[model samples]
Every structure is written in structure tokens, then in C-alpha cells.
Target chain A: DAGVTQSPTHLIKTRGQQVTLRCSPKSGHDTVSWYQQALGQGPQFIFQYYEEEERQRGNFPDRFSGHQFPNYSSELNVNALLLGDSALYLCASSWDRGDEQYFGPGTRLTVT
Target chain B: QKEVEQDPGPLSVPEGAIVSLNCTYSNSAFQYFMWYRQYSRKGPELLMYTYSSGNKEDGRFTAQVDKSSKYISLFIRDSQPSDSATYLCAMRERSGSARQLTFGSGTQLTVLP
Candidate 1:
């Protein structure tokens, strides 16, 4: 079974550019969450999507937003990206709130 | 202080030796703890999880949580080189955002073959 899938394994963009990252959750899971992992750091929570709506969010700025589709896949969009936005964007999926979340190979975004 | 603090050790140990990794937290409300291992260019994979204050063992791995001391540990027995990766500690409160996880800077472990 596929654990989780993320698109554009790697991406490169300049400052002020906009980026959209994709994710497909594991089979039988409905919740999708996004995280940002900076170099030499742990993953930081961004927000979580459940039932096509954002149920919870972290300390991230308004620049980060997300959407959950009917099929449980999700997308993370970042606008007016800054140099600090460059990091590995990770997506995780679980059955419900606070369950064991499985992750996918993240999308590495580099801003120049 | 950050909610969770972990040492980023490029900890090196020989194969078949036991390895210990640990983390401390300032959030007393956190009741769930998890350990994840990530290889280069890959997302973290869950290795073990413990709830509140207790110990849980699975095969070659054991997770111990001491709520009194606000510290947690993961012990790996009979380590293998395949176990060489970055280990992250994540914890969350009971009623907070799902995985409102406070993650620690991971520790890079190398099991020499």
C-alpha cells in the first residue's frame, strides 16, 4: 500500500514567487497535514485539513494555506515566498486527529 | 525555552551495540510522545510512540516516558547500519490541534558496520 505521495520531488523558485505542493494520503485515511523542515531542523507543523476544511493551524503566517479534496488529497500553497521559505515541505496523513501519521518523501523547495 | 529540546548528536556507535536517544520537554501538558526516523531526502517514518508516563517495547526498540522528569527516551538494541538516520522526537497535548507537535531538533545516529 502507498503510504503517502508528494509531487515535484524538488522545486526551485526565486523570491516573491508562488508555489503549490501536492499530497495524496495513504489508503483509508482522511486527514492531511503539512509541515516545513528547515535544514538541520525538525519538521514544523503548518496546518491540518479534515473533511475538506482546515480544522487546526500552527504558528505559520497567512502566507501558507491549504486545501483538502474529497478524495483526501491536499495541497499547500505559499504566496510571496521569502528566502526563509526554502525548506523541505512534508505532508503527512492519519485516520483522525492525533493518530499515527504516515509521511511521504517531501518536496524540497529552494529559493534563490 | 522551546517546548521540546533534543541534542543533535552525530552519535556514532558500532554495529550490534545498544544506542540511546533522549529528549526533554517543558510542556507538562504534552501526553503523547513519538519517535520518527528520517533518511536523507525522505520524510520521517514513525519508529515508536508512548502515551503519558510509561514504557513500551517493540522488537528491538523500546520507548520510555518519564512524565515526572519530563523526559523521554528511545533505546535501540542490537543496532544495524540500516538504523543510521536522523531521529526526531515529537510530542503533543491531549486536546490541542492534531499533532500540534512540538518537535525537537533531531539527532543524527550512525551505526558503524
Candidate 2:
């Protein structure tokens, strides 16, 4: 089966601009979650999407949002990007809540 | 203090050596512990997982959790060059709904041939 997949392996954005990253969960998966991994750091949870609605969120601000579609694909949007927003955005999917998550290759976002 | 703390080691070891990686957490509510291996420029891949405490082994990987001490460990036997990567420790609390995982800074390992 195909594993999780993400689009635009890399991206570049300037301050005050917005960017969207896409993800397709592994086949037979239903929930999608997003994470941000800064340089020399582990990934921090952003938010999670289930049933086309946000199920849970982490410590992130309102500027970080996400959507889950009927097909179980997901998109993460970050608005008013700051230089600190530059990091590897990772997408993870699981069959259900409280299950092991599988991660995608991630999209590297660079805020210039 | 951070929920979880791990040593970010650029630890170097010779091939065929046994490698031990570990992490400590301050949250007692975290019941599920996991270890993920991530290569440079790639997302993390789940390597081992354990519920509550005790040990689970998969091939060369053995994951151990000590709930009493709030500590978790990953042991790799006969390590190879391919085993070199950043090992991340993640945990989440048991809940009926989805919960966000808290991760550690990850330890980088280099198995030299």
C-alpha cells in the first residue's frame, strides 16, 4: 500500500505571505494531523483533522489551520508567515484516534 | 520544563555495536510511548511503540518503557550504517478522541563502518 504522501517537497515564502501544504494519508487511513519540526528540534504538533472537522489542536496559534477532505487528504495553511515559521512541515495519519501515526516525507517551508 | 527531554547526541559508534537511546517525560498521563527514526530531510517513521510499560521487541529493535520512572528506551542490536539517523521519542495520553503527541529533541546516531 502507498504510504503517506505530501506535495511540493519544498516551498519558499516571504514574510506576511501565506502558504498551503497538502497531504494524502496512507490508504485505509481516516485521520490526518500536522506537525512542525524546526532545525535541531523534534516535531511539535500543530493540529488534527477528522471527519472533515478539526478534532484537536496543539499549542499553535490561530494562524495555523488545517482541513481534512472526504478522501482523507489534508492541507495545512499557515498565514502571515514569520522567519521562525521556516521548518519542516510534516503530515501524519492514523486509522483512528489514539493509534500509531505514520508520517509523510514533509514539506520544507522557508520563510525569507 | 518541557514535557519530554532527550539527549541530542551526535553519538558515533562502530558497526555491529549495540546502541541504546532513551528519553524521559514529566507527564504521567502519557501512556503511549513511541520511537521514530528520521533520516536527514525526511519525515520520521515509526520504529517502535509500547503502551503503558514493559518491553516489545521487533527484529533488532527492543523498546522498553518504565512507567514508574517515566522513562522509555530503544535498543538496537548489531547496528548497521543504515541505522544511523535521528531517533525521536514521542508520547500521548490515552483518550477517547485524538490527542496531539509531545516529542523530544531526538538523538542523532552515526554508525561508522
Candidate 2, residue B21: lDDT: 96
Q: What tens digits encode model 1's per-residue C-alpha lDDT throughout B49-85?
A: 7886888999999999999999999999999999999
DockQ of 2: 0.88
Candidate number achieving the greatest lDDT relative to the actual structure: 2
Model 1 lDDT tens row, A79-100: 9999999999999899884468
TM-score of each: 0.97, 0.98
Candidate 2 lDDT at A77 equals 92
Model 2, docking class? high
Give the distance in Å from residue A49's predicted Cα in candidate 1 to where it truly belongs: 0.4
Error of 2 at A58 (Å): 0.8
- In model 2, state the lDDT of residue A101: 96
lDDT of 2 by residue, A48-81 (tens): 8999999888889999998888999999999999
| Model 1 misplacement above 4 A | none
